[model samples]
Target: MSRFGDPEWGRRRGGRLTPPEGLGVLTALIGKQLRARLGSPAAPPARPDLDLALPDSRLVQDALDHCAAECAPDIVAHSIRCYAWGVLLADLRDIRFDREALATAALLHDIELGRTERRDRFACLCFACAGAEGARIFLEARAASPDRVTRVCDAIARHLNPDVPLKPYAESHLLNAAAALDVVGAGARALDPADRARVLATWPRGDFRRTMQAAMRREQAAAPNTRAGLLMQLGFGGLIARAPFGDTL
Candidate 1:
């Protein structure tokens, strides 16, 4: 297995398209493209939270340390950058959310990615559910409150769902937006360009395109009926290639 933990990860797979399972994702994605292309506001949204760092609680540090140890280096960096991007998106919309939940969820969202082992339920599970369960176990072991544990796991589980509502699921909604921005540059223009540049400079992408592409394929292969598979059917490789970020910052 590669350091990424999958042997097939080096090979290209999705040679034939499966026509999306339905038109809902397609419609949502098209709407996303249009929204991303829309004109920027005359003035940027006021977001003092953009200056704040990731939550400093012990739970947050535990999450960062565990994720860094469990996942690939670039994947960990991507997760941290996901937190920053999600924070920016939350501030852009003035979404009231728990920073601790958001921070822990963002950092742990992809911790179970690239699992083709099928050696256990977690490895065999769908993309989002697997990671969410892993997070659930981690938080539960630490005696996290039931509500906080639910919040983090739910956010991680729904991070791949592009159309998650913002009213009560701000954590999930922001995570999805952040992941899309980092992976495909889908909504990069929604935030201030300077802040975007800063986020990248801090946690620069490093061969992320290659690793993330391979990871997505690993998930699709492990669970072809999942949203991961749906993303591939929707031309995910093309999206990754088209992302604005290069192999480095």
Candidate 2:
């Protein structure tokens, strides 16, 4: 058994789950355990390379659980990985940010994708914008501080527009970069190899590449005149083809 209590935490083989494979899996399992423990008051010593202090508030956990419940398994996994990558990048870049705000933004960024009724709004506006609006409503209902709600909503709104500047907020910039890295492996080369390996091992992309492609296609079909549709028309094929991970799609 792995340190995280399940040796088969992220293993897939022969179209069925399997036992953990290598030392990388063990390392990632341990890393996940450490992060979970950090959510407690008497957490273990922090790693010098990165601050693993994630949001432990009841609201934060509720948001995470809500996202997981509403989204597909692959998308939930993607959101969690985005949070991990965003914080790691923030640490590496020496960027100062609100840890809870960043965590909230990362975990709920693509939430609109999980809502079927939002298709009409998404047809007119970008999914990111729709998702941002949804996030804002949810946060406000939860009584999150006005400043935190704004920051998280803003980060979610701009996460898709990599070309636009994410300035004045490290959380937004890191979230954008992190999503890009996860989606198409953009900017992934800049991350430490070991760290990248551990993140992937812990989350295990599964069928994310194909799932993401299908989601984008659906978005395009619904909103062919929107930014997502325009991007899909322009070079989405090339982007998917260039993704570093296995293209099972």
In terms of TM-score, the best-performing candidate is 1
Kindly give the stretch of ten consecutive residues in candidate 2 with the minimal lDDT sum: 5-14
Which stretches of candidate 2 lie above 4 Å from their native place? 1-53, 114-117, 121-124, 164-166, 247-249
- RMSD (CA, Å), each prediction: 7.2, 15.9
Write the residue-wise lDDT of candidate 1 on 1-249 in tens digits.
311101121112211113452356678778877876786564375454456478889999999999989889999999999999888887777788888889999899888788657426653355566677778889999999998887787788767765677745578778878888899987777777778878888898988999989988887776666667778878997899889877885
lDDT of 2 at 90: 71
Q: Give me the overall lDDT of model 2.
A: 0.67
Check candidate 2 and list the clashing pairs.
Answer: none
Scanning candidate 1 in windows of ten residues, the lowest lDDT window is: 2-11
For each candidate in turn, the TM-score is 0.85, 0.74
Off by over 4 Å in 1: 1-22, 39-49
Model 2 agreement with the true structure over 1-249: per-residue lDDT tens digits: 311111122111111112332333344435644754555333233334664444788877988898888788888878888888888767666778888898898888887753435656432245676776678778998999998887887787767553324466677788878887788876665566667766777777888888888888876776655445555766664676677866331
User: 154, model 2: CA deviation in Å?
Assistant: 0.7
